[model samples]
Target: MLKALSLFTGIGGLDFGFEAAGFTTIAAVEANTTVAATIRLNRKWDVLETNLDPRRAVDICSSTIIKDAGPLDIVIAGPPCQPFSKAAYWREDGASGLDDPRSRTLNAFLQVIALTRPKAFLLENVPGFAARGHSGGLDRVLTGITRVNSTFGSRYRVHWAKLNSADYGVPQIRERVFLVGAEDGRDFIFPNPTHRNASGTDDDVRLPLYTTCWDAIGDIPSSSDDSLRMKGKWAGLLPSIPEGENYLWHTNRGGGMPLFGWRTRYWTFLLKLAKDRPSWTIQSQSGSASGPFHWSNRRLSATELFRLQTFPQNVKCDASRSEMQRMVGNAVPSLLAEVLACEIKKQFFGAKLDTSKSPTLAVPKSETAPRRTAVRPVPPAFHELVGTHADHPGTGLGPGAAAGARAKRDALRKFKAA
Candidate 1:
């Protein structure tokens, strides 16, 4: 079996996937005490608690931990992505694009490549890491990797791409950027997308339909009785919002309360699942107020969230509800990781990409049909509650009415908080 080393390993998501692809994890580094403990509880591998600091390049190079292990065939890492994340960028005290302190994590990752000189490396990060604002940081990371490869005379070939986990049969639409580098100068092409958007016009019959939210966790027992249910105004409002819609659906334009206008609120505010569609991205920092509520108007259970992330049901995570939520949300979907690992195995280890052991779900033939024609009608009770009249224009609060818009916006915030 090929030997692998993992960095920033969060609950061993990538480690498990690569192991499933026939690689053995020799060691892993994770700084979070709780996450590292969880990894130890579930996996039999050496775990490191130190942060990957490029400044400690010499000590890391000659570290006893890696020296005790044999040669490494591959190194995989999913560095902290907060510095370049879109969510962070929008935060009040967020990083300044390329200059964030967290950006050093990528440099430390490169320093590992320089020190260990593995046959290949796989780097995973948020899609926003490659965004225009952070392109310089990305370029620096690539340059650093190239420099290391050149110094070692490895002549590594690198390929990078943005991939959506939903296209690999994960029930959530999580997009990430992956950078794969091979030391032997072999060209590395990304794996072909095995699933297509179920509701789109893509006519590629070779690809399967995208996995739906129902396909992932429909059978999981409802968490409504669990202590995770929504409270306060959300309890009253969510049940009335249509499936696959959010607070925007309750706007006056949609024949509901005139608290806010369309597109004024966050996409996940009051979001509910659509039984027929894939889920929106599972957020790492989800809370009671940050919703992607079940169609039943309740929060999803830990197991349900795990299923959406494509983690095996048997995989135990010994952590609290909130910690588990962060771990699952931040994890690379095992299916997507497996696909990438298979490609790496084929390229570096001369191994065939195995599909027989992969999980398979039965998709109905009808689900493959285009979803454009499926229109959900407004419930009659909702229309009555919102005081909708047939002759009235659909416009809720008229545009260009600044004073009315501001009042409605304030009301929306109050309603959301309540």
Candidate 2:
């Protein structure tokens, strides 16, 4: 197993993705009480929790991680981005890279990366990395990493790329920046998205844009199944489901009491099916009655969100409703993680990790699908998923070789966390 470590480990999303990809995280560092509990409950691995902020360099350089898992194979994390978030203060100060308290967390994450001296590392953050404000700060962070690498006589090639979650065949259209690093001159490539988008190739039969939201999750039941019942803490009252089998058949809705700092509003988008398109972005909370979630007036359940995010039927989250919702909202879809994992296996391991083991959207996680004890069959492709993005070469299959099999399976898992 590729021994790894996670920093700024919010609800263990990156940890989950890397693990699914085949790496074993030796330690996870998180500071939020609720998030800590979520990580502890979900992860069987060791997790170190502290509400203490990371502004203090001393505290970060000497944490429990060093005391436990000495030096790792890789270090990964997404430092908090709200301060630099476009949705927050970044847009106002002429995009002067707001000093987000959350951004400071990155200082600690980087410190850990240096200490661990992992062979490879990945730093994930918002799209702000492209802007002047964030770019300026990130430039320093990058330089610092390189400077340290030089001192250690260690060679690292660092590259940054903006990846769209949907570009990889995930149902949602989320996008993010992945800052990838590797030892010396080792070649590490991101996965080629196998799903096509709004733009299509010459073949009309192949999928263009996305397979609709309904197509992504048409197999699961809207209700009446015990597995779909709510398990997390309710952020607000569950929106009343109008008698209907699908979100496409939605109706008018309303508002009521508030939960947390957010008030209740009929989230019309979650329940209403898009016009022959995919549904809105799935959130972490299962019961938020925000728009897109509330169709006509009914709220989308946690199970439905799980499906949209592309989680297997058997994988279940154990946090309270609100906590689970927040965790899911912030998670990197499992399928997306799987794709990243494939890159490691293919590019880093070179034929060691089999890409053919997983399927795409067409196969829901099932007993019929491959399992720990069963012989696995080839996974199917979604009928709507045809040609890949013009940019993606479609898994680079060789003569008489397997094509797109693993891409689809990874995409299915990513949709849920992404």
Candidate 3:
């Protein structure tokens, strides 16, 4: 298995996904004590607890963690994305990019690179990082990774892509940026999105089963206002509907009126579209922002929020409801992680035999071994997710057109070199 080190490891979402994909994360560096504690309790893995802001790059990458992580084959991190997200205030204020302290996380992540000299690394962030005028920061990251690899005698090249989690079989249509860097000059290809779990269902559009609001967590009991675990249906007055079922917990319902309504009804127009079509982007909102979920109703529950992030049923996520919601909204889904890891393995190890697939490290029978859970496959109907190009401020992606993003990235690289 590839030896991995995870930074900014939030409750192990990236760590768990990586492990599930067959990479072993020997060490994770996280600043939150409560969240870090939750990860250790659930996974029993080593954690480096430090609250020093990530911009303090050199300190975090200090030799101690590098030693503990030991011979890191891969490094993975999802830096905080709020200040750089499109939804953030002042984003349209001609704000020069990378002024925010949080934006320097990649610099710190690279500091570790200069020290540890890992063979490969992955950086995950919100799509806004690729937005126009923001390319300066992106270029810094691209050039830094490339130059570091070059100097270390390891090749560094990146395949930067923005992917929709819903298209990859997750229940919600959350989009994020994934930048893969490989040292060996091996072409790093992004994984194919396997499932389209979100789609327009209410429409008479004759596609098979693209996933719907009713599919992923439809089996859970109708949300009750009293239950922190459950919130009343999104449309309180609409006909209660059956979505799907989980491990016999309760009957999941769909399409209920939400708490936020002007006419005692959620925006029926948007609701109708979401019922059958894949949702717009599940955004990285600070809760101070208004459009991440894009419904004029009660917010989605933590578990439901986690569902959109494609987290498995058994893995526990501990956070305040709002914290959980934001966490899921910001994370890189583990399914995507699995896809990327497999690709890296093919490039690095070759067919001589895959280290990721080999179970050479026998699990020591211990009282506290992390329980393995079976992965649920992306449903076939998930690919039916449908959407039109639309962008409303603070909600959804920028018109669903990737037309010039690649070109911009290229031009950005040349600009940086100049």
Candidate 4:
């Protein structure tokens, strides 16, 4: 079996995925003690409870990992992605990508490649990591890998793709950028999507139907935990939002109240799952009003979240509800990982895998979704909030963008003054 080293090993999604595909993770690195403990709870891989962005230095950090796990056949990392996420774009100062100090983790990941000289490396991040103007970090990564080739006299070539988890039958429509490369200069081919939209609109018939929410969690027993109850002022509004709809449902353009403007709120606001459709992306940092809520008008239970991410059923999370969400939300879908790992083993390591077999972690198909619930009328209390509200002007022209520009000007002024 090929040996692997895991970085930013949140909830063991990537590790579990690769393991299912015949790679053994010898050691895993994670920054959060709570999250690391959760990983240790399930697996026997040596858990290094240290931040990858080391206080010592990048080279020193790599040395410690090497000392703990020894030489590696591969290094896999999902660096902190906030620096390149959509939330970062809406921040007061706008998205900084690599300029954000947190992005040092990306450099640290590359440095480990230079030091360990793994036969292959895989890096995962939010799609914004490879966005045209926001992809400075990607350039740095390619250049750094090239340097690793020149220094070690290895022929490393990189290939990347933005893949959706649903395309691989993971039951969620989460998109992430995956970059993979090997020391032999062999161009890695990303797997063709094995699933396509189940919605009968498309003519493509070569692939299986997309795994849906019901497919993933329809069989799991519902939890009665009070913690799963929706909270906050907007909690009551969730039921009125139809299945697979969000705050947009209450906007002027929708079937309900004109309580909001088009494109004014974040996409996940009061979002609820439809039994028949695949889920939207699960978010790591969710507000009380943020969603992808159960069609039953409640927050998803831990097991449900895990199933949607295609994590094994027996894996236990010992953390609080919010922390559990953060760890699981940040995870790469295990099914997606398994798909990539199988391809990697075949292409890079010459390992034999039955290409015709489905990923072991893929959720089973369910023939029927639960009956849709009735949409409730807007509560009388919220009727007062209905009125004419302006739609967001456009990207970089919205109110948030104006605020970001002002904040930038103030920062520059302060810097000049100092």
- Evaluated with lDDT, which candidate comes out highest? 4
Which is better, 2 or 4, measured by lDDT?
Answer: 4
Clashing pairs in 4: none
User: Residues 265-296, candidate 4, lDDT per residue (tens digit)?
Assistant: 88988999999889999999789999889998
Q: For residues 1-418, what per-residue lDDT tens digits would candidate 2 score against the true structure?
A: 6777777778666666677677787777677777877666667767667542445445654667555556566777777655554444312222224344455665675566565567788877667755554574467568867876877877777777778777666666667778777765486777766566665566633643554455555555556544334333231223332221122222221221111111112233234444334555655434433434423233456666665666545546666667667766776666676677657656655646655555333323222211112112212322122222122122223211132334444555777779
Tens digit per residue, CA lDDT, model 1, 231-278: 754466676677787877767666546545566556788888887778
**Weakest 10 consecutive residues, lDDT, candidate 2?**
256-265
lDDT of 3 by residue, 167-199 (tens): 555445567788887777677778655453324
Model 4: per-residue Cα lDDT at residue 167: 85
Alpha carbon lDDT at 369, candidate 2: 16
| Alpha-carbon runs more than 4 Å astray in model 1 | 56-61, 252-255, 354-418
Roughly what TM-score does model 1 have, to 2 decimal places? 0.83
Candidates 3 and 4 compared by lDDT, better number: 4
**Candidate 2 to truth, TM:** 0.67
* Highest TM-score scorer: 4
Compared with the true structure, the alpha-carbon lDDT of candidate 2 equals 0.56
Misplaced by over 4 Å in model 3 are: 51-59, 62-65, 89-96, 196-209, 225-299, 351-418
Q: Relative to the true structure, how large is the alpha-carbon lDDT of every model?
A: 0.75, 0.56, 0.56, 0.87
